[model samples]
Target: MLPAMIDIGVNLTDKRFADDREAVIERAREAGVSRLILTGTSLECSERALALCERFEGQLYFTAGVHPHHASEFGADSQRALESLAAHPACVAIGETGLDFCRNFSTPAEQTAAFERQLELACSTGLPLFLHEREAHSRQLDMLRACRDDFERAVAHCFTGTREELYGYLDLDLHIGITGWICDERRGAHLLPLLRDIPPGRLLLETDAPYLTPRDLRPKPKSGRNEPAYLPHIARRVASETGETEAALRARVLANSEAFFGL
Candidate 1:
């Protein structure tokens, strides 16, 4: 069986856990999740993520960078600030950064600029890129291609694209992070074929918790909040869909996480 889970993406700075963050983490450990990588989406959130890392000690690690949605706020000094946070031993990667055309929270030009800047920083620090791309896969891929020489490690986190997009990412040698979104019947069915094609070594599992709760939940949390505690269900579903034993799937996912994040 898979050893346990390492949630590669989560937004703990979200207020959804204001009252019971400790309990949430306790639940994750109960579910066999050994580590949680809190995503740093903005400067403020990065700081909060760092604080949470400190609070949880070795159980929780964090990234230090900004999200594309906040790209408009990215200034010349943003890289320096991110570098300071990323220097912390608990900081595992640099981002949640990329292009998000769906939200339009930032202009396309601004997002592109910010994406490149963070990619450069990640290259400089030798940290993996925790990427987010939505409704802009073509442009995102183009940007990645431009930085192909610079970026050595990256994951397309919370991937929700088509099979072609999946192939494109894999062809570029980037890792794939799967979220509980795959458990949804309506929108996620299209991803089954993609799931079938992913090699054991290239896949990573994540909750993107406080967000995409898996469909098989029992005694569901009242607030509809997804937590790392629910990660095992994600693995189970992937096993069922991919025709692999759950134990084998779990072991592969654990290995993938270790290699991808250097955990």
Candidate 2:
């Protein structure tokens, strides 16, 4: 049998799981999710992520950086703080940071600045990047392409991009992460062809927990919080679309994740 899968982008700090975080993790483990990586959206959350990593140790890892929504809060000392947090043994990657033009929570300029700074840090530290990109894929790809000379490794986490954008990142030798969003029957149906195009070794999977829940499951809470336990559904859908066994997909995704994050 293949080893249990790893979810490389969950936000455990999200209040959606406040009532039952342990239950969620346990359920995930029971469902064959052996590990999870929590995303730290800001300095405070980065510290919290580290604490959770300490609590879970071998089972949980974390990334340290600010989300684009918090970009305006960054300052001269912010990168220093991020540097310190990233030095933690549990901190495995350097972002959930990038452009989020879909919401424009932060101005485009500030988002670009934050994203560049984090990329520089990740480059200097020789750690991989866990990036976010929404409607800003074109700009995001432009920035990454410009800075491609500096980055050693990167993954466009929760990828929602055009086939061209996907190939653009692949051209830069970056990995791609898929989330429960791919299992959505609505807007995500279009991703099936793109899924077919991605090579197994270049693909990693995430839950992006407390966020995009897969369809075809029983009803969720009234608030609709997603969790790592639902990760298998993402695997199921991918395996179905790719015409590969669930076991093989699970193992390939785990290997891709382990190699990307050096976990």
Pick the lDDT winner.
Answer: 1
lDDT tens readout by residue for model 1, 82-107: 98998999999999899999988999
Q: CA lDDT, every prediction? A: 0.89, 0.87
Cα deviation in Å at residue 97, candidate 2? 0.8
Question: Cα-based RMSD of the predictions, in order?
Answer: 1.2, 1.4
Number of clashing residue pairs, candidate 2: 0
Identify the leading candidate in terms of TM-score: 1
lDDT of 2 at 191: 82
| Candidate 2 segments exceeding 4 Å error | 219-223
Q: After superposition, how far is residue 129 of candidate 1 from its true place, in Å?
A: 0.6
Please, what are the lDDT tens digits per residue for candidate 2 over residues 1-263? 65699999999988778888889889999999989999999999889889988999899999999999999988999999999988998889998898898898889999989988998998899888889888888788888888788877999898877889889888888898988777778868778889988877899888888888776666655667788988888898899989999998888888888888888
